[model samples]
Target: MALNRYYYPTKYESRAKVISLGVKCVFISHQQNDKDAARKIADYLINAGVDVYFDEYDGDLRISHQSNNARAVTDSIRKGINNSSHMLVLVSPNTLRSTWVPFEIGYGYDKTDLSVLCLKGIPKGSLPEYIRTANIIRDIYDFNIKISNVLEKSQSLLEETKLMSSYANSANPLSNVMDAMINDPYN
Candidate 1:
């Protein structure tokens, strides 16, 4: 499938701010049977300047060399989730039956700052219970929007954090004294 690179308004101040932020890395979770779809999503994200972490693309050689132990695989997945800013779970009919996807989703939700998104690979009303709580993307168009939104929101949060840190570190003895007085009970 041909995927077009998405462009946001570069002239707008808010868009510019989002653009200036570092690349948003995404960890993709998919069943081994859904590699083709996962690759397409990875390509789209890469073309849009987003970093993608997919085990099929990056971990196959390593896994083959290793003992293929369940603990080893889970550890690697945990590391990927921890390093990524977002997680995209491709939910195909086959994926529903896979054991690893649910574990990846739970690990991502409990262990990291990653925003989890579920992308539908087939027309199905029922989704796995683990992904029901996540933001769902129904098609390629929705996928583009969800990925863009995640990056923009993450950048905004990062900017806000930086601003708050700067303000906190600024020399403000009067504010400190006021805080000290307000909290002091022996005044």
Candidate 2:
């Protein structure tokens, strides 16, 4: 219920270097087994110029315990999603079984842009309902594409970027104009 102030939208022109607004992002994954992979995903995003607000890298914000920790973990993930513009959910077999991950996804539903990247072994069939709706990527490279798209939708600032430059130059100028007028006046 707290207001989120950390989400930032990046703007990039077709030929111009991508300019990041330093958006705060949250990483959600299995704590015990997927922690290392979570760090790797965070690192990849960081290297690509997006700021990451992962619990593993940020702090021990996510609570730990057996049953009682559920509320605390949910609260922590909610706060993270609330404060972040985007979420990077690492999907694996372990991730699919995680109750907290679904809670996190539920907290983020229709609230923040979400990107789900599955590790090599994770099955698409095992994905939870919330994450199943996400554009699934097999690896890190595919993750970047999904992330870019999610970021673009969330920001409304990357439409002009080369990644989606065609959208800006689409045949439907009316829609673009309306979007510019309604969603992005400066763009």
Candidate 3:
């Protein structure tokens, strides 16, 4: 694989953003409809000092994959997943309708540390069955603990962020949409 202008560039090449840290880069998998919630989760990971490959922020991923080229989309996604050590699937009711979410999960199934993070307003048995076996991030508290376990010094950072969520005028650095517990349908 030589770098040449002839090859179609993926997001990593187009953005020129390099992640030197070799540890835990997370590939966030969510349906397009759940973008806002996924962004919040990505933000929390970013705040925790984790490198994330959330497609929304990458213009190259958006531009290259929207041309209806199956190869382009699959390549872009594969690259993102391969570059990551973890995959956090932000599961919501919208996810059930997503074609790509299932693909992402399956492709990264054996490679990345996968976790399914629930959103609000979901029921206990509503989550797709395939994802139930993965580690479930039950709530914000569970998220905090999981992150802390993954990275040293994250506990304090999360505690500080959680405190920030308490301010009435301030938007939660973690999540503005859900409080301590998300809308977990499967408990």
Candidate 4:
């Protein structure tokens, strides 16, 4: 199926400083059933020094279980998905019919380039029909490899962007305008 493309930066006008700080990510999936896997992935990313946003921690503090904190969790999840630069989707059989998952994927689809990890095998006789034609990986092992590849690409881009920004900041005449304003010779 066709999916809507998200807003990717066409040209580097100013500088994407936050982007160069590794992959700041949000995990979008069905939280109620995928909590364990979500937590595992989040923890893995955390240990890898990637900032991860998951819905499990978004709800009411008093509500111990995530099942009891739907409203708050959903709001937080929406915000988190919107704020994140990248999304890691956990796709499975149950995920196809999951109303929330598609919306989450579509949210990422509208906002940014998404990296999807299909923990389960792909469906036969026509795809899930809801999700876009996403690049699928067989399992978490493949997912980890894909994540590694994406991370490497992101890191390289980050470094390149950093250098470009550094050069741009130094080369641009506006740099002097701001600097001169700060270090006023008139003062």
Every model: Cα RMSD to truth: 18.1, 13.5, 6.6, 18.3
Q: lDDT tens string, model 2, 116-173?
A: 7666555335666766676555543344445465454432333344232222344422
Q: Estimate the TM-score of every prediction.
A: 0.61, 0.59, 0.77, 0.56
Task: Give the clashing pairs for model 2.
Answer: none
Give the best candidate by lDDT.
Answer: 3
TM-score order, best first, reads 3, 1, 2, 4
- Residue-level lDDT of model 1, residues 31-72, one tens digit each, is 888777677666656655566667764453367437667777
Q: Which regions in candidate 1 have their CA more than 4 angstroms from the true location? A: 1-23, 64-66, 111-121, 153-187
Candidate 2 ranges beyond 4 A from true positions? 1-26, 29-31, 58-71, 147-187
> 33-78 in candidate 3: lDDT tens per residue?
9998887777777666666788886655677767777777888788
Residue 118 accuracy (lDDT) in model 4: 46
Superposed on all Cα atoms, model 2 deviates from the true structure by an RMSD in Å of 13.5
Which segments of model 4 are wrong by more than 4 Å? 1-23, 60-74, 120-127, 153-187
The best candidate in terms of TM-score: 3
lDDT of all predictions, in order shown?
0.53, 0.50, 0.70, 0.48
Model 4 score (lDDT):
0.48
TM-score: model 1 vs. ground truth: 0.61
Worst 10 residues of 4 by lDDT: 178-187
lDDT at residue 78 of model 1 (Cα atoms): 66
